[model samples]
Target: MKYDFDEVIDRHNTFSMKWDCREIHVILGITPRFDEDTIPIHTADMDFRCCEPIQRALRAVTDHNIYGYTGVFPGGYGQTYYDAVIGWFKRRHDWDIKAEEIVYANGTMEAIRSCIEAFTEPGDGIMITRPVYTPFTGTILKTRREVVNSPLVDREGNGFYEVDYEDFEAKAALPSTKMFLLCSPQNPTGRIFTDEELLKMAEICRRHDVLIVADEIHGDLIRRGNVFHPIAKVAGPEGIITCTALNKTFNIAGLQATNIVIQDPALLDTYRKNANFVLPNPFTAAATVAAYNEGEEWLEQLIDYLDDNIDFVIDFFREHMPKVKIRRPEGTYILWMDFRDYGLTGDEIRERIYEKANVMLESGPQFDPERGEGFERMCVPTRRSLLKEALERIAAQFPEG
Candidate 1:
């Protein structure tokens, strides 16, 4: 309990997309039925304060006030940030890493989009597991590449989304399939792929000469007892392209800093060439270095608090909202709650929350084009008091048919 995670901070008037339902509604072409007073749990971003180390780093950069072009490869703290990544892998997963193998990114999603641009040509097949982060699908499709969804299977009671290996292998086996975008500690159902699963996936990709674009963005936020096995470690010598960012782990999403690790030299060369003028965000870079170097203690505390929040929420649902089934995620603060038991469509759920509850949550239909229709993703990173209040708002509208 070194840090008080329950500190309530005012996020309104800060231009946060989460707090403004009207802004989202206007942009997305939906009518804003919810008022300005609604509490939003739609955005994937956290509500925690930035770590002191990150704030210091950003402040140091602003202290200079020289916001100009920065193209230098060896920017301030680049070496330190790289070193921190190496140490993190060593301490957490016992994996050895070399500094030269990784490259910086504005963000994981941007890196993923650039990877699509760099590694493959237009019309190439970029495979992904559905019920994934929404932007991932668009990242591929936006690049003029095809989004081939190898949807994950949820065996009525297993909770986490499991892939059909035969289907995955079949997709990789295709001549058009060039890359597989794997979301570890996956969004929505929050399935952390085991080492055995990684190996099996690696085997398929390797045999088919397909590249694996592993998005381990939520890797560091993993829960206890669940081991996050990085795909590159098991993909033989041709390790998968890893896309990770410090934004999610440290609640610095606005900082937009990430590291894309490509073990193969040829692939690395291709990606670096693709992102010709793209530079690692300067302020973001500085903050990432500081956070990685001095923010481990903060991270440990944050994870512990989040774990408690996860447990509390799970218990709350089991007791008061038993109709809403949640698959306890092994990672990430975003909890995927299945509301199919209520027999409400996605639109119905959205309307009910906005009209009756005054609470806004992310509709599942946005994640996977299939099962996303009947689910909702709730972010549990805010203060427990706020969460309790939001749930109470919904409780007032309980027993809705």
Candidate 2:
């Protein structure tokens, strides 16, 4: 591999939220549990270094050192910023989008918040399937909307979770339910919604007049055999709003850049009016163009590395920790593991992992209180050796029964 994903760069004292945030234990309601030596396999941020091309682009900005107020969209020779996303969707997803349809935002959550504020009234219902990404709920409540859960069905004996269409339709049928926030290549479970599943979901949301906010932020990180069906593709272009970014894929999240694509001019207008959020930093804008254009090779290589990591995780657990079950994620670097066999509550599991293993993982309850119980989300976007060591620590503490 041209990129050395195994290389570990020390992030301690770097002000990295994932690594340096002692306050996380406070947020998680645990005593501050870890030191600088703790392996934070908790947050979604990649432990590996970012694509070189993106770093180089940011470096050029630092070299200039002007640091003045910058325009929102790249202009002049930099019009490639627009062309970058346009060409990306076309080349990668086979989903063609126009320049006018694209809107820039700092992050996916910001875009979702804006969409919620724009389309839904306070106290209106927003439907989500769980267990899901943590921020999905945070953004909903932040905007004063009600969270309507259409929890997914946990298939018996198998680790895979499936969408509960009946519950979904019932939830959407609620008159107050205004929108559905869809996470493609879903975060913790890593299930890529099949075309059939997406069609069913789209039909229900459309029939009930619920707007669709598709967060395809993890779309590019799909495993080899899986296909990512964008909600817009199934739901059509009308009321669907697709949010995507290179932050997760290219590990440039600190840049705070994301792309929002909405085909409906009236809806876009409403969203822009409500969101009125800050524009991307000049470095982010510059690096985004570089990521969408030149970062493809790096992304492909990264996916290959992640694929191996996934395989290693599955094998390691099967061999050493058979009590823990994993479905083998279809997408995302985040691997959801079920520790229910140990009969421990989510908090118990989390506390054990922290105190005994000294590895920080996102507890399932943090995703959804009920569905997330007995589950833990482990991020595998780090060096394989480090991941193995973390797993060894965990396995040593939670040995197979």
What residue pairs are clashing in model 1? Answer: 364-372, 365-372
Residues 142-242, candidate 1, lDDT per residue (tens digit)? Answer: 89999888889886754668889989989888899999988987886778888888888888888998888888889888787777867787554484899
In order of appearance, the predictions have TM-scores of 0.94, 0.96
The stretch of ten residues in a row with the least summed lDDT in candidate 1 is 69-78
Deviation from native of the Cα of residue 32 in model 1, angstroms: 3.1
- Report lDDT (Cα) of residue 278, candidate 2: 64
Worst 10 residues of 2 by lDDT: 70-79
Which parts of model 2 have CA positions greater than 4 angstroms off?
74-78
lDDT of each: 0.79, 0.86
**Prediction 2 global C-alpha lDDT:** 0.86
The residue-by-residue lDDT of candidate 2 on 1-401, one tens digit each, is 29899996898888898888898766765435878778888888998887888888989999998777665554576567889988988898888888778888878898888889878899999999988998899889988999999988876957677888888999999999999999998888899988889888888888999998999999999999888877786667877899998889889788877999998787878877777856667898888888888888899999999999999998998888888889988999989898999887767777778877899887888888876788888999999999999999988887554
Superposed Cα deviation of residue 168, candidate 1 (Å):
0.9
TM-score of 1: 0.94
